[model samples]
Target: MASNHHRLSGAPVAAAVDSAAVRITGLTRSFGNRQVLDDINLTIARGEFTALLGRSGSGKSTLLRAVAGLDHGTVGSGEILVPERVSLVFQDSRLLPWLKILDNVVLGLPGKDARGRGRAALDEVSLAKRESAWPHELSGGEQQRAALARSLVSEPELLLADEPFGSLDALTRIRMHRLLRRLYETHRPAVLLVTHDVDEAVILADRVLVLDDGDFVQDLRIDLPAERDPGDPGFQHYRTTLLGALGVLPAHRTKEQS
Candidate 1:
């Protein structure tokens, strides 16, 4: 895949020591009189896994689109500075049905090395044998795996995910979480995952942020061990905190407890 066309100055620069992967200041997005994102400011450090949570229409996806440069026409004020190379994964696999899975993975990639890299990415997702298969032939989980491989094949500096696994079944989602964690360990791309599931956010992200009323309501660090259990006190505390920020009572935790 080609590098993202959206850079602050359209010029490459070296990443400063411990520099942030994404930085937004005074960012705003409006549609007529309705402002979806209001002067949001955030910084995501290199290689950090951050999860964004919010109620519907709270501007989570809007913010991500702005960061991805897909909403440039709607973006107003502020600035979004991202690394030169970037990639995005969406809720849907979004693969072309007519293209073979391998061809889809190598879509925009150039040069003789493209095929090699694409196959390697597929192998990483445990789909090496399915490269010749069609998109319609794969299960939801498999399609998602292919989507992930396609995004990672480019080796981006930052990876933006908009609820990448939200469409999967419960068991498949769990497996994808593990797969994502392993992939992050190996690739170390700065990631921003926009998700609705508070538990999923807490389980997968190094930091969890809640966006509400067009601004950040909560920014909490996960400080738990990598191997986490949802039943653990620390994990539950973070989950409760995020769920509360969204103004919803946790189904597993009572109102008073939350």
Candidate 2:
């Protein structure tokens, strides 16, 4: 494995070909006197969809950033191993306002067929026709779609998303959820989605993890059918379990009441 003692490195870890897509052992991150992540250990298998739920400042984003190699300062002793090809999507569509949608998607992409791949990616997200539109011209949800297109343009093996739909309206968020599920099915990338919404995590992930006070408090496998319905009894059970983990629901609350 590619191990770093005091800092997290994105370098590809040398492991068995059949090993997990991501592996972190004893990972810790601190900001001055505050420890954001405390000896975190996690493993994400190939093509697995895992959702992380946590309250604000609970170290969810901090852990995701460490795996993405976006955090560079003073990580405590640990090792993080991830696929060399990883893509990240943030809460806001960080597309440059000056670039057209197509340009934004294909930016820094290598190969002579980069534009073709970019167009295909846009089409996958239903944004092909809007390729020529400026970033400012699209709605918030549309801009996020463009951002998704950009993330998938490279066919990454791992996708890290940090509350990518948090800012959207309720209706738009639902639509985006459907789109994301479809894309995940189509691409089968190992996905780590960080969200504060318990229902969203239950609906989208194969397994849901709840982080509290810089450590994972719960890891629940979601065994519902792929065509998940919010009204399904099994779905409700999982949602309630996660809500209790997040302290959104009372520990003694019944599943039906959640």
Give the alpha-carbon lDDT of every model: 0.85, 0.87
RMSD of 1: 3.9
Which candidate should be chosen as best, given TM-score against the real structure? 2
Cα-lDDT of candidate 2: 0.87
lDDT of 2 by residue, 20-79 (tens): 888888998888889889899988898999999999999999899888887765546688
Candidate 1 clashes between residue pairs 3 or more apart in a chain or in different chains: none
TM-score of each model, paired residue for residue: 0.90, 0.92
Number of backbone collisions per candidate, in order? 0, 0
Task: Report lDDT (Cα) of residue 126, candidate 1.
Answer: 100
Candidate 2: worst-modelled 10 consecutive residues by lDDT: 1-10
Error of model 1, residue 127, in angstroms: 0.3
Measured over all alpha carbons after superposition, the RMSD of each candidate to the real structure, in angstroms, is 3.9, 3.0
